[model samples]
Target: MRAAGLEPLEPYPGSGSPWCCRHEACGREVTPRLGNISSARQGGCRYCAGKAPIPPDEAQALMRAADLEPLEPYATSMTPWRCRCTTCGSEVSPTLMKVRTGGGCRFCASHGFDLTAPARVYVMQHHQHNAVKIGIGGTAGRNERVNHHRRSGWVLARDWHFATGVEAHAVEQAVLRHLHEAGHGPYLNRDVMPNGWTETFGADLVTPATLAAIGTALLSSLPVTLYCSGSSAGR
Candidate 1:
């Protein structure tokens, strides 16, 4: 019995009586007839006595299907495991059931990132395209913004700027309309560009000079608007 897998829990001093042993898989103790090799080797633990535990391979497959990479030793489906979210690349220790139920990253879901703390306007340019990308950065912040673009194969061309998300949006719209009226019409490139910024890609469409002008105009507009709004509220 010792040579076999069963752990002997009692002194068997060669006594021709029933032997007490415990199964390693499940801690259930049982008495087998002395020298009964077959019965002694067939001790089943508590977990094995009921339903079989899920195999590691099957559990890993389930996690991969839900875009989560398992980072813990998988024992059962109910075990709390640490997994990385494929979407935002954030780690979260969610139970197997929670992941199986199509749960996503709470950080992204709740917009709990730095970008969302205060609305941000950002200017980014891609090397493949001539136009600078002016858009609202997601709540993830500037670093995440760069990561997102790089993942999409867009190389950052120039330095980026940040302002209030709302004011940045206004600047974007104003620049777009101004460029369009000057015969740079239909700047929105919905098809090719992944980020969907007002795409003005041409030799003379948008240059460093253009960006400087827009920035200056936006800087002047913000203070005036704030003053006007304050006057109205006071009145």
Candidate 2:
């Protein structure tokens, strides 16, 4: 224990029992099991391991620098700290350690498709495999998603533009669910279409016209704000 930077305060208990000791580096009392230390399962001191309680002022400063305003007192490093995003004004709770490690407010992160932005839902057909795929993508990418499939020999059968990706995604999911309930599932495997197999289905099970109708029906059921613009076929 001494070699591990911990000075035992009591007699050596069994390896399984908790042993109270003072961390020589931080001078903080800690109770750790000898078995854990012997087996290298955990460090002798949580403070030295960066798992101990952090100073509130320092934690707040780190959060502020990340454009997050803390709404609650600082807790453990791994626990979520309720904060309001200064950039998007959206309330979010992100762990302090995650923020320290370069993670920030998820609402402000542009890692995936922006659901609030305009997008398109497309139906594609792969004639050789007799398969069809229904998917959605952001309009900012200029039909790149459909064009990608087109390059893979999956011709674009139809596409509808919506005001938001969220609306288009909802319609796409509804169509997929309807097809699933009709005893149709993915027809292609990863080896066939690595990134898009999950959305592809046997064309015999659902024709392009049927898919377009399903998407239109789903769109009609949505609020007026979620209405889609004109659609195109055989692209």
Q: How many clashes in each structure?
A: 3, 0
The C-alpha stretches of model 2 lying farther than 4 A from their native spots are: 1-109, 224-235
Clashing pairs in 2: none
In the range 1-235, model 2's lDDT, one tens digit per residue, is: 9988999999999999999999998798999999999999999998666777778998899899999999999987766699999999988777887787777886687765576888888887889999888998877746677777878998777788788876776677778778888888788997889776877888887888888888878776765254444445434
Error of 2 at 3 (Å): 32
- Which lDDT tens digits does candidate 1 get at residues 145-199? 5467667655443332343444444555566556666776534364666445434
Give the runs in model 1 whose Cα sits over 4 Å from its true position.
Answer: 1-116, 138-143, 153-163, 186-188, 224-235
lDDT of each: 0.54, 0.81
TM-score of each: 0.37, 0.52
lDDT of 1 at 167: 48
